[model samples]
Target: MDGTKALYYGAVALVILIGISVVLSVISAIIGLATAVISGIVTLAVLVGIGYVAYKAGSWLLGDDDSASLDSIGTGSSSTSVDAGSSRQDRLRKQYVEGQISEAEFERRIGDELETEEIDDIDRELERER
Candidate 1:
């Protein structure tokens, strides 16, 4: 009876040890996978940053007028890309708020936009009269 009890206890301990080992193995695999994923993401971001910098440098060196950066790559005209009417005002306002343009620059650009709109209305009226 004593030998039988000792054997039973030894079997239970062995099973528990195997269970713990399996759990640790699974945890190690998960940690390794997470590390690999993070490394890949960081590498991708760095590559993109370098590419963008190179593109900007090349454009500057070549004296290219297309200053969209990453905004509208193949779009020729800057004005049309931003849409027409009030949306134009909204874009200017957004730029100003984002510190891309100074207060004076914002005021000047907005004034120019308003003038252009008024001139367009006048042109349409004159054409209608004709």
Candidate 2:
């Protein structure tokens, strides 16, 4: 081919190659951006989960747990009011008031009542709900 035609064709080929490179770079940038966005979201979600767990641990450690109390040694349910707590307790209280049961026996029975009642009541309540 003549020198002018050769140079013109070479320039055209170079321009085409540059155009392809630009298009490929643009596609690569878009993919990279998408990957970055997805990773950021995952990191944020993991961090939030960790933060929530930490908050619960802190609350429990600081004696802020609302489940167990001095009076009630079990999960306190606010929505479902337990109308009658362990009937055994009522009888014990009545006996104590009537001076039939000794103070020591009354205390021991009350303790036993609380322990058994906590387990049975919570299990029955959960089972009923389920």
Q: Which one wins on lDDT?
A: 1
Query: Candidate 2 lDDT, tens digit per residue, 1-130?
Result: 8999999999999999999999999999999999999999999999999999999999889977665562264335532334345566788999999999999999998998788768877787786688
Give the residue spans of candidate 1 off by over 4 A.
67-130
> What's the C-alpha lDDT at position 129 in model 2?
84
lDDT of 2: 0.81
lDDT of candidates 1 onward, in order: 0.83, 0.81
**Model 1 Cα lDDT, one tens digit per residue, 1-130:** 6999999999999999999999999999999999999999999999999999999898888876365543355333434534586798999999999999999999999999999888866765675578
Model 2 clashes, total count:
0
